[model samples]
Target: MLRYSAFSRDPAGGNPAGVVLDARGLDEREMLAVAAEVGFSETAFLVPADGGFDVRFFSPRAEVSFCGHATIASAVAHAERHGAGGLRYRTAAGDVDVVTARDEDGSWRATLTSVPPVVRDLAPQDLDALLAALRWSAQDLDPALPARTAYAGAWHPVVAVRSRQRLADLEHDVAALERLAAARGWTTVDLVWRQDATTFHARNPFPAGGVVEDPATGAAAAALGGYLRAGGHVPLPARLTVLQGEDLGRPSTLHVAVPADPAAGVAVTGAAVAMP
Candidate 1:
């Protein structure tokens, strides 16, 4: 059976993730089929491991290295089963450590540390192709952030928009963008807008995953946090909130913390509630 939760929410706003607590007997084909059937942006499958759990993430179209929202959902599910605390996940990408706790309101929250991240500037031609796919002009992009490719567990093209309205009016050529992303091995086109010094708005276009958009993207957020920290855009020990899925009405909020250590992974925290 599959358990569903909209992470970073009280059963309402947030990205919906599917969690399979017992995924021992399933093979890769079975997992893919299950994810397709679930039809969420991603699904987390957990199997027994040494003192912790082995996890895998699958999109409707294919398997991914790691997925942030699904990870949060899985951790919360594990917490509900084993009691709220800390848990380590051995994922396809790498080892991810997560801590789960219950708030005063009895809501379960989970914080996950990402793998080491990196950011690189996108090639001009590639950026142009991506812009064509999204119907966004170079003028629409934010001058400060520029276009770059970032990675935590998966690769995503970070495109900062000048305004939230540009982010909200997302319309893209799916097949064309899918081909571009597949050729580049990119997971998603991370569209973002800086709302303030410590707040941002984001929209993720995930054509490669066969999803039109992601309401909340944990991996991309981790990458963005790393990028910002490395570029010195935000100060050390800063906690930034990423508001996403607002256009879709899911309205997910992702909290990310960046430390001074460049080698350290970003910390992403959010609540996950079981869907009825």
Candidate 2:
């Protein structure tokens, strides 16, 4: 049976992720079909491993290297079965170490450390084509945080908008964006609006995955955190809050903590609740 869990909240909200606790017999096509049937942005399929678990992520359209929200959901589900603490996940991208615990508020929270991240500047022609597909002009972009392609476990284009309104009004040509993303092997387009140094708003366009928008994107948040830290955009040893899905009304909050170590992976923390 497929289990549904909403990460970063107590079931009522946060990003909903589908978890298949046992998926030993499923192939890629079966997994993809399951994910589509579940109807979440992504689903986690877990198989037994030596001391932990082997995890794979599948969106509606295809398999992905890694997915943060689904990771959080699966970890919490594992904790519920095996008791809460540290759980190691061997994912397609790499080995991800996750810690699950009960917070003071009695909520189950999980933090996942991503793989080493990289950021590359976007080409002018590519950026122009993306803008045309999204119907966004250069004037809507923020000057401080220029456009770039960022990757932690997956690749995403980081587009910083000057205002939240621009981010809220997300209407893009799905086929056009999908072609561009497929050509570049990008998972999603991270549209962001910085409310302040520590607070920001975000929206993610995921045409390649056959999803219009991702309510809460832990992968993109990790990439953004790494991008900001690498670029010296934020002070070291700082934590940032990303408010996402507000425009979509799902309203997810992602907490990102940046460390001083350059080689360290970004820490993304959130709570997951089981869906009834």
Candidate 3:
């Protein structure tokens, strides 16, 4: 298994992912075991399928339909060995297309186009439970960006806080959040603070995945981009940067682009570095 940190140029930053370039013979049990041994938030196992590849993601405790950091790390790993180009990944969520290229600084960056995103209003009861688990009152939320559940491969509840301080001081009941997430089939709670028109700060609590938080969440970022476009939160054809994991001391950055077409997939771009 190859180790990589996605969405950062440095190894110590970003979210770490384990990449298994070849897992042709491994069964589900074996893959889960390996992922557990790797002990990262998630691990990618690639098996050649139909001309592209069939990718599976496993967290330490369970299998997930999609994982953004693992996808980014796996794409970069493939590009480093097979040369930069487009690659198709058949994930449990859906077919995802990723493109990798070398940057001017000689670092490799990968861009993954998410599946068509969906944004839905959170039920009042569910929202109340979520806020209770998160220990965040309704008044702390941003009025402009209402609470909604966004889905792009994975489902995330996008909760936009009014102030950066509200986002920074994150303290949640993990067990309560996990129960709610599992009950609702949510992957993460995307806590965000908008910095400006093109900048934002985000924190993702991934209780269902068996992780407390994610340093960089591409799937949630994509979902948020789609939500912004669909809800007119951001202008069409907008490129936004999300800064995450800084509070965890492993800073990471995610670049998201939202197009005018509401049905189209959002684009998420970031660089990955091999971990030593």
Measured by lDDT, the strongest candidate is 3
Better of 2 and 3 by TM-score: 3
Cα error, candidate 3, residue 263 (Å): 1.2
Q: Estimate each model's TM-score.
A: 0.97, 0.96, 0.99
lDDT of each: 0.89, 0.88, 0.94
Give per-residue lDDT, candidate 3, residue 166.
93
Q: Which pairs of residues clash in candidate 2, taking residues 3 or more apart in a chain or in different chains?
A: 8-271
| Per-residue accuracy of model 3 over 80-120 as CA lDDT, tens digit each | 99999999999999999999999999999999999999999
The residue pairs found clashing in candidate 3 are none
Residue-by-residue lDDT tens digits, candidate 1, 1-276: 455554565566788888999899999999999999999899999998898889999998899999999999888888888898888899988999999999998888999999998988899999999999999899999998878898888899899999988988888998899999999999988899999999999999898789998989999999999888877789898899999888987888899999889989999998888887
Tens digit per residue, CA lDDT, model 2, 56-157: 999988999999999988888888788888878899889899998987877788999998888889999999999999999999999999999888899999
lDDT of 3: 0.94
Q: Where does the lowest 10-residue lDDT sum fall in candidate 3?
A: 226-235
RMSD of 2: 1.2
